[model samples]
Target: MEPENTTQNKPRGRVVMLVDNGVKGDSRVQKAARSAADAGWDVVLFGVSPDGEKHSWKVGSAEVRLIPKPGPLNPRRHDMRRPLFRRPLAYRSPQVARYRVQAVKAWRSDLSFRQAAVKAARAGHPGRSAGGSKARLLVPRVSSKVYSKWVALRARETTDLQQRRSMLDARLDRATTALWQGLMKQRSWRRLTPNLWDFELAFAKHIDKLKPDLIHAHDFKMLGVGARAAVRARAAGRPVKLVWDAHEYVPGLPPRHGRWLPGHVAWEKEHAVFADAVITVSPALAELLKKGHGLSQLPTVVLNAPVLSPGPDEVAGAGPVPDLRELCGVGPNTPLLAYVGGINPVRGVETIVEGLTQLPDVHVAMVSVPPGKPYAATATIRKLVDKLGVGDRVHFLPFVPHWQVAEFVAPADAAVSPLHHLANHELALSNKFFEYSQARLPQIVSDIRTMSEMVRSTGQGEVFRAQDTDDYVRAVKAVLADPERYRAAYDKPGLLEKWTWEAQAEILDGIYSRLLPDRPRIAAQPSGSRADARA
Candidate 1:
């Protein structure tokens, strides 16, 4: 079936979005694609595939093109063994030992295949002696098993050493991170640039073929990609526009080796000059991008709010929706605290798990989508839950579709955001905050500027000291103590209308309309509205 929002008539224009991550879990990219499609634009999304296989499929109103990376480097063909040889011998973790065993098996398999090919080629050659060919084949047959055993032993030793070093490095990560951050501050910003992965390079080449009228870069990583592609297209006489959607404060991102925040900030400053327009999720971040990047224009703020319900009754009656509670085997009266987002370290998931130990009556259902990195914080949180003996109180639900998130969360007594006070978290206005409002559920948020202001102004919930387990417990209890007072805040006239994505999407629609003034105009629709629910 044709995806929702896609027109039977010819599209007004084409827009290609460059998303570094896959399209499945990225709500921002999904929203952008839907918005563009609703406005009569044919949308194409370029993203990564886990396996090295190229493929295309329809996702809602957009065409998704996924490019995969090459498989692991072969030790025989490349310098992969050089690094292994350099490591000092030491004890190995069980995980590392198993990996080394697999690597050795693969290496031996490759060697066996090569030897078989050589033997086959000798049989076909006219000049080779039968005796000499038999000897060559016999030599490998006799020594191959011994050689494979020797290689396996060496791999185990090397992997053991690497695993030991990894353990040591983990202990010193904090000190090393601080030292690296200090060194990065002194280095020339010009020297820092994002290393383009093979898939990204392939994506850039693929984009050249599309020659889209507009290019929408999802986050900082794709800013340069989109800008460069637009420049190439414009140089070829195609009038292409570039839109940068800065999802977070790039300059204030957590410190890491090589790709420091300052370096990324500097790189983005240079690339922003190429963008025809800039877009961001929150007003606080928009202002930061304007001042930090020195953009000619202030970025339009497209808040990641929940889409509006069909009517007031839908919002009010959502609380009684039958979901999660029965599936999780929790009582109807049990105070269910819902947290819907990526379960990452910065989001303070550990604190939430820890705090649940103190709140015996309340249950927390973590409806988590995967973060940028696979299982970045989920493993740690699981370990903590087991250690704290709070497994019964803390439930984990697999990520649901964007439209179905409301149904899952609607049954909760309250929504929680115990995010740590990192630079990005402090200035952040996350989707969960508005989602709680949309579900008419009270919020329990971190005592940060943006979310605190939201709760205080709207009178929808309570905020406590960020990263403090006791404070979080108290804040959640305070809200649950008088649920009606907090619930009444969401019922205030016009509050839900303001927080809905239907209102927020208008800003996005306006930005595109202004960017392509000559294109045909279509009435903008909310992403995942009834007509587009099939997405």
Candidate 2:
């Protein structure tokens, strides 16, 4: 650990990070942890714990704070929703006008409910004396007290639900103090998207408490928490350096899947402008931030790949990869094609399935994320595949831990990323891109700018023209036909090589050593949404 600079003149910065639900139970989170610890920075990771732990706890060298997990893993107990009491949306929207409307409505509703209930009682007891009304009264004192308490409790509970609903109605305002508290409480955002954000908050809170020199937030979902945490830290006069890693294009999130209603572009646009340094996983996204977003001030682009070597195992949440033959009844020799990660429309797993149906001899295995996740288009695709008559050939392993993903892919004849072109996918440098490369395996991927660039650079994969089923079909068939070519591709050096959390950690170590040296260091604004132009 870097020695604290107790010298009066020496400045020692203390950084506090908020990791959100993602940094827990994820290899990337572990990688972030390694980066912080290796850099000799004190880090507290606020996120939920796996297997139902109570209280905030430390994982490895970093603290892991627990946030309530969302939803029933069993599914039957609750649909993809929070209990009414936990709703953030029900409270009010973030927009002043809409939020005020909701707030006023709530105030009125609670007031009216109490007034009406009391008025009815008073009218019913019109003949009661004033002294009796005050003392013995229209009702028993115990009963009145209990009834008032129940009414107040009911109103408060109802308000919580309304707040959650309002939060959703207005679009999830992640870049604020309000969003994360829900995940920590399981009262607001946690109930909204349990799997998505619960752990992210716990990690962020712990990060905030530890006061590290540097903070790394991966992906857009966690960005809000990281930003909010930084904002809070700075407000408290803590100095922290924040590294904002963009795994995918934020504005491009919709339309890759069936679309989940709509969200405000301003939210992400504002966030993009607000980040300290916009680190992108893909060059394409870097270009987007530079060109489209007018973020002249944001220091952007420190590209990354998923770590190839063993990462933090505690967060990996993986056991040995499930045996496919035993689980699926498929012979060990059966040719398998695999697609991992959120099975959303942008991923184009449906295209992979259709393309595979053309090949006929291959099977498709989806190892990450279940079809049932509300956000996944996987279920919809499954029904479509059944209609297309290839249902049995394609299967889902659901969300395997990051550690076991390679296990699922190892048994496959090929891996693929058949993504639909979008701002998000166009700028995406997906984890699976490097995951396949680290395994030294051949892959078929979308011809999106970022993905194609990787395939061309690494020579480890074939690029199917974007969203073209025939292109996917041909690519897979060619790999199946030419084992030598596949081997040739796999033998080539990958961008995935020389880029592990270790290397990133060394860079981070240097960053912290220079930035902090003794005590913790901090950025002017620790993290999130730094626009080049003043906001």
Q: What value does the lDDT take at residue 501 in candidate 2?
A: 43
**Cα lDDT tens digits for candidate 1, 138-177:** 6655566675576567667666555544432444543544
For each candidate in turn, the TM-score is 0.73, 0.60
User: Number of clashing residue pairs in every model?
Assistant: 0, 58
Question: 1-535 in candidate 2: lDDT tens per residue?
Answer: 2222311232433334444454544666666664564344455554544455644544444445545555333221222344443443332222333444455556545544554555556778442232233333324445545655554554565465445444344343333324444334323333334343333444554555455555666666566566666677778887655666666665566532211212223334434544666666555677776775676644344434454444343334535557654555578777777677776666677787677667777877767555344445756887888888987887766665554455556666677888877766677666676666555567888888777886777666688887788877888887777645664765545434454444555555454555455655443221222111101
| Model 1 worst lDDT window (10 residues) | 72-81
Q: Residue 19 CA error for candidate 1 (Å)?
A: 0.6
Off by over 4 Å in 1: 1-11, 69-194, 197-200, 259-263, 308-322, 369-383, 524-535
Q: By TM-score, who's the top model here? A: 1
Report lDDT (Cα) of residue 365, candidate 1.
90
lDDT of each: 0.71, 0.55
Query: Per-prediction RMSD in angstroms?
Result: 8.7, 13.4
List ranges where model 2 is wrong by over 4 Å. 1-15, 48-55, 67-212, 215-238, 255-276, 291-304, 307-318, 323-333, 368-376, 493-496, 517-535
